[model samples]
Structures are given as structure tokens and as C-alpha cells.
Target: MDKAEILVIGSGPAGLKAALSAAEQGAEVTLVERDPFLGGQLVKQTHMFFGSKEQYAAERGFKIAEKLSREVEAHPGIRVLCDTTALGYYDDGVVSLEVKGRFATVKPQSLIMATGAQENTLMFPNCDLPGVYGAGAVQTLMNVHGIIPGKRVAMVGAGNIGVIVSYQLLQAGVEVPAIVEALPHIGAYHVHASKVRRMGVPIYTSHTVLSAHGKDSLEKITMVAIDQDRQPVAGTEQELDVDVLCIAVGLTPLTEILFQAGCKMVYIPELGGHVAMRSDTLETSVPNIFVCGDVGGIEEASAAMVEGSIAGLTAARNFGYGKDSYEDQLAAARRELDSLRSGPVGEKIRSGLKRLSSFGEVTQ
Candidate 1:
């Protein structure tokens, strides 16, 4: 079994920051990523992020990923295992792994779960068609692999991912016929929505995809206006002759490992889905096991990074690392997180966190 002072899973913005924070505190850190490379979803994002300077504001998402991944690769106190999947956590506190198909184990004094999230799918007739894809998949095809998804695309959900992906599709020389959202208003930032609108992509609020039509693959999709109760209105059906249908409804926290570890879980829709109950310091109910990023609750990459820093700092402090500046560093992380979630845009997340807190403390 390999040993580590701190073990961080998922190598996304959160895990990268976690490993760096702990390593800088003199901890022996091991970062694990299931993908052949690090950076998680950030690697597939081509849009510039919006946040304070500490969160790499104004920098393109992929550029931020490149910077963080480079730092992680060069960190002396951190060991990185890409193409490795953490299989499970056992009662004995050992984490089983499949590293490039071979079994391995890691016994860590502290385990930080930064597993991030998975895209949520929309349901409709023929939604399983070949050309249908999640927003993340579309992003991977266009941004990462340089492959355009389709000639004309009709997007479902006017949320950030959907709107941003639409813009990216336009950037890739693909036409976006329409963006449909069941909600009465667009869920993305006004700037993103405005940009897509200026690009001639129409956004239909109070609309939903009724069904998709194709014999072998996706050829077109039927959408309709929805009422406040979310029921389709009569005679509002419309068809878009687009080859691709992109679903960007939302995401859910990836908490399988947390479940296996027997951590307390709570359901928070605004946070995406069921998440592990964690302390303010980001430690889960299961003692030294900590959770940051989407596994705790879905939030932006900036907040996830800050939470990772908090988790790593707290975990390292548990082992006498960074005793001198631990308090200062932790306070700074907390302040950053608070600032990120302070504005009106953070209301939903704030409400979800409030619900989670109502469950009271999860005893170790």
C-alpha cells in the first residue's frame, strides 16, 4: 500500500488547489485523476471566468487549468496519478484504486474528496438519439478535441452551461438554431445571454423540448412553450431542423465514494443533488475524510477552489503542518468563499446551504 499524508481525488480545480495547499504546508500529498490528464471540466471550458483576481478572473478557463496543472506537475511534495480510478473506501481506512487497470491501495492519514460533478440529462422521446449530448460532452468535442458537434444545434436549458456552449458552438462555426428553457427567464449571466442573442441565437423562455425525431440518428427536435406550471401550451409546438440537441439542464455531485465511506448525505437541489454533509472546515462526518467542490455541493469553480484550499489547510493543520499561519490562511479562504457567494447570483446556493445546515452537525 502506498502511504500519503493527504490524498486528493479528482484533480479538478478543487483537487489541484487542495494538493497544492497541503503540499505547501509540508504535507506528503497524492493527487489522483481518473482521466489521462488533470484539470477535470476546466480543461474543456474555453470561456473566460468571472470572479475576483484571486480566482483567476478574466482568464480563460482552459488557461487557468493549464496554469494549475503545470503547478501541480512541478510540485515536489505532491505525487500525481493520472489514469487512476479510486475504486472504494473500506472500513480499514484504505482507498482501493485501479491504476491503469492494475489494483492498488493507498492508506492516507487524510483523504480529500473533490470528485466534482456529472452532467444531468433531460428526458424526452428519442432523447437517446445519437446526436444528443450533454453540454460537457459537446464542450469536450469542440474545445478539447477540435471537433464540431453538428452544423446546427438546438440547445435545451438556458443555464450557464447551455448558453456558454451555444456561444462556443458559434465560435466553432456551428449554427445554434435556438436555446430553450422551461424556466421563465434565462439562468445564465446577463452578459452570456446577451452575447448569444447578439450572435442571432434566439432564447425561448418558458419552453421545453417535447420530443426528438430521427430514424437512425437525430435529425430534428420538437419544442413547445410551457406554462408556469410547466405544462405545454396548446398549439405552441415547433420543430427545429438541427442535427444536434445539447442538454445542459444542470449537474449533480459525484458522491459515490462518499456513500461508500458512509458519510452523512443530504439532498439540496440548488447544490445539484445529494451531497455529503460537511463542517465549515470541509471535513465530512467520517473524521479525517473531507469533501470539497461539487461532492459537497455544486458551485462555481472559484468557490470550489477556495473550499479546496480550506479543506487542505484544515487537513494539514490536523497533522501539525502550517501551524504558524494556518489560522490566517483558513480565514482568508473562508472570506473568499463568502465573497463569492455573497451576491444575488449566489442566492440559490445560499438557500441550498441553509437547508443543509438545518440538518445540524454531523458528529464524527
Candidate 2:
């Protein structure tokens, strides 16, 4: 069995930051990523990030990935295992992993779960068609593999991912027919909406995709404006001639390992599905285990990095590293977390936290 002071799973913004932070704190850290590459979702994100400069905001995600990877590599104590997927976690901090075409075991004193999230799916008429694809999948094809998903695409859901992917498609010289939203208002940040709107992309609010049309590949889409209850309004049906249907509803946390490890979870939709509950120090119900980033909840990359740092620092302290000022460090992390959620878009997230923390009676 491989032994380390700290082990981080996943290679997304959270995992990389956690491993880097732990190593910087003088802990032997090992990062395991399921993908062959270092970056996870960030590598497929071609758009710039938001938030403060400290978090590398306004920079392309790929650039941030490159910078973070370099920093992680520079840490002699940090070992990153790419293409190593963690399958399960056993008692006594034993983790089962599929590494490089073989199985391996890692027994660490502390663990940070930063597995991130996966795309959510919606059921609609003819949704299983060949040309209907997840927004992230399309992004992976274009950004990572340098291949266009389709010539003309109709994007479903006006969330950040959808809006950003639509703009990316345009940047990739693909035609975005329209952005359809079931809600009465835009779902993404105004900045993202403005970027696409200026490009003459029509955003249809109060609209929903009813069905996709095609035999082998998508050729057209049927959309309709819906009432408050999501029922189609009379005479509001329309058909858009497109080649692809891209679904970008949202993402659900990748919590399979957490479930396998018997970590306590709460189903908070705002947090993006079943998430492991953590204390102020980001420690899960299991004393030696922790979770951060999208795996704990769906926030931006900036927030994930901070959360990952908190988890790493706490884990390091738990294993006798920087034990003197552990409480102070955790309190500082909590303050920074509060600051990250002190914005308009963060209101919902704040509410979710309130509920998750049970109105602060717990998790405080």
C-alpha cells in the first residue's frame, strides 16, 4: 500500500489546490486524477473566470490550470498521479484506486475529496438522440480535442455553463441558433449574458425545449414558451432549424466514493445534490476524511481553491503539521469563505449554507 500524509482525489480546481496547499505546509501529498491529464473541467473551460485577482480571476481556465500544475510540480513533496481513479475508500484511511491499468491501494493519514461534479441530464421528448449532447461534452470536444460538436447548435438552459459554451461555440466558428431558458429571466451572470447578447444571439426566456428531431444526427429542435407551472403556452410553439442540441442544465457532485465510504450526506439542490457535511475545518463526518470544491458544493473555481486550501491546512494540522495555529487558520478560512459568498449570485448559495448548517445551530 502507498503511504502518504495527505491524499487528494480528483484533479479539478479543488484537488490540485488541496494537494499543493498540503505540500506547501510540509506534508507528503499525493494527488490522484481519473483523467489522463492534470486539469479536469478547467482544461475544457475556454472562458475567463470571475472574482478577485488572488484567485486568478479574469484569466482563462486553461491558463489557471497550467499555472496551478506548475506550482504543484515544483513541490518536491507533492506527487500527482494522473489517470488514477479512486474507486472506493475503506476503514482506517485505506483507499482503493485504479491506477495506470492496474489496481492499487493508498493509506493516508488524511484525505481530501475534491472529485468535482458531472453534468446533469434532463428528460425530454427524443432527448436520447445521437446529436443531443451535454454542454461539457461539447466543450471537451472543442477545447480539449479541437473538434467542433456540430455546425449549428441550439443550447438548452441559460445558466453560466450554457451561456459560456454558446459563446465558446461562436468563438470556435460554430453557429449558436438560440439559447432557450425555461425560467422567466436569464440564469447566468449579466456579464456572461451581455457577452453573448452583443453577438446577436437571441435568448428566449420562458422557453423550454419540447423535443429534438433527427434520425441519426440532430437536424432541428422544437421549443415552446411555458407558463409559470412549466406548461406550454398556446401559440408559443416554434421550431428552430439546427444541427445539435446541447444540454447545459447544471452539474451534480461526484459523490460515489463518499457514498461508498459511508460519509454522511445531505441532499441540498442548491449545493448541487448529495454532499458530505463538513465542519468549519472542512472535515467530514469521518474524522480523517474531508471534502471540498464542487464535490461538497457547486461554486466557482476561486471558491473551490480556497475551500481546498482550508481542507489541506486542516488535514495537515490533524496529522500534527502546523498544529499550533490550527484554530486561527481555520477561522481565517471561514472568513474568506464568507467573503466569497457575499455577492448577488451568492445569495442562493448562502441560503443553501444556512440550510446545510441548519441555521448555524450546527456546522458553526
Candidate 3:
């Protein structure tokens, strides 16, 4: 059986930071990534991040991923295991894994789940057509693999992902006919929204994709405006000729591992979808089973990094490591998290956290 002081499942922003922080605190850390490479979705993010300098603001996401992955690889205390899928968390505290098609098991004193999230898809007629794609899949194809998705694309959702991916598509010389959003207003940051608008992309609020049309692949799509009651308005249907329909509605926290571990779960829409109930330190109800990143809740990558740092520090402290300055580091991380979650953009996250804090009352 493989043994570790702290096992971090993921190699994204959160997992990378968690492994680094724990290793820096003199803990033997094992970092496992399912993909053959590190950096999770960060590798496909071509745009610059928005946050304070501490969060590496103004740096392109892929660059940040490179730096973090380099640190993780060079760290002597960390054992990097790429192409390893964490199968399940057993009742006896042994986590099973499949490393390159071979089964293995690791018994770690503490486990940090940074499994991230999955994109949410919209339901409509012919939505399962060939030309339909998720925002992440589009990003990977274009940014990572250097393949254009289509000549003309229509995007669903006006949130950050939709808006940003639309901008990226435009940069790649793809024609974005329009961006359809069911919400009454665009959910992206004003700067991003303005950029897309400046580029001649019209954002349709209170609109949704009604159906995709094509026999083999998407050739056209019908969109319609909706009322405040979320019902489609008659006579508002508009059809656009497009080859690709990208869905970027949102994401749901990937909490299957936490569920298998018997962690308390809660449904918090503001945090994306259902998430495991966690404490300020990012520790779940299951002792020594910490969670961070999108696995705990949906938020920006910057916030995920800070949460990873907190979870790592607290997990290492559980093993009596980092005793000298654990409190200071944890406090600093929390303050940074609060600052990141401040302002109008963070209102939804704030409300979700408020609801999560009162989980007992909510459940009762």
C-alpha cells in the first residue's frame, strides 16, 4: 500500500497550490492528476486572470499553471503521479486508484479533494447534435489543440465562461452570430462584456436556445426571447445559421468522492450546484477529508487557490506540522478570500455561503 502524509486529488490551481503549501510545511505530499499532464483546465485558459497581485492577477492562466506545475514537480517532498485516477474512498480510509490502467491504493493521513467541476448543459430539441459542445471542450479544442470549433458559432449563457469563450472564438476568427442568455442581464464582468460588445457581438438577454437543427451536424439554431416568468414569448423565435452551439450555462461542484466518503452535502445554487458542507478551514464533516477548489464550491480560480492554501495548511497542522505559523497563514488566507468575495460580483457567492453556514436550520 502506498502511504502519504497528505494526498491531494487533482493538479489544477487548487490542487497544485494545496500540494505546494503542504509540502512547504514539511509534509510528505502526494499529488495525483487523472490527465497525462498537470494544470487541469488552467492549461486551456488563454485570458488573463483578474485579482490582486497575490493571486497572480494580470498573468495569463496558462502561465500561472506552468509556474505552479513547475514548483510542484521540483518540490522534493511531493510525489507527482500523473495519469492516475482516484477510483474511490473506502470506509477503512484507503483510497483506491487506477494509475495508468493498473490498480493501486493509498492510505493517507489526510486527503484533499480538489476534483473541480463539470459544465452544465442546456436541454433543447436536437441539443445532443454533433456540433453542440461545452465551453470547456471548445476551449480545449481551440486553445490546447489549436483546432477551430467552427466557422460560425452561437453561444448559450452570457456568464463569464460564455462571454470569455465567445471572445476567444472571435479572436480565433470564428463568427459568433449572437450570445443567448436566459437571464435578464449578462452575468459576466463589465469589462469582458464590453470587450465582446466592442467586437460587434450582440448579447441577447432573456433569450434561450429553442432548438438546434441538422441531420448529421449542427447547421442552424432557433432562439427565442423569454418572459420574466421564464416562459418563451410567442412570435419571438429567431433562427440563425451556425455550425456550432456552445453551452456555458454554468458548472456544478464535482462532489462524488466526498459523497462516497460520507461527507455532509448541501444544495447551494449560488455555489453552482450541490456541494459538500465545509468549514472555514475547508475541512468537510468527515475528519481529515478536506476539500477545495470547485469540488467544494464554484468560484473563481483565484479564490480556489486561496482555499487550497487554507486547506493544505490546516491539513498539515492536523499532523502537528506548521505549528509555528499555521494560525497566521490561515488568517491571511481567509482575509484574502473575503477580499476576493467582496463587491457586487461576489453577491451570489456571499449569499450561498450564508446559506451554507445555516445548513442545520435549512435541513431542519
Model 3 off-target regions past 4 Å?
360-364
Writing each residue's lDDT as its tens digit, candidate 2 over 245-351 gives: 99998889999888878778889988998888778777887777899899998888888988988988888877778777767867876777787899788887887
TM-score of each: 0.99, 0.95, 0.98
Model 3 score (lDDT): 0.93
Q: Which portions of model 1 miss their true places by more than 4 Å?
A: none
- Cα deviation at 213, candidate 2, in Å, is 1.1
Clashes of each: 0, 0, 0
Over 1-364, each residue of candidate 1 has an lDDT whose tens digit, in order, gives: 9888899999999999999999999998999999999999999888888888999889988898899999999999999999999999999899999999899999999999999999999889998999999999999988899999889999998989999999999988999989999999999999999999998999999999999999999999999999989999999999889899999998999999999999999888888889988888989899999998888888899998998899988899999999999999998888888899998989999999999999998789
RMSD for each model, in Å, please?
A: 0.8, 1.8, 1.7
* Candidate with the larger lDDT of 1 and 3: 3
Worst 10 residues of 1 by lDDT: 292-301
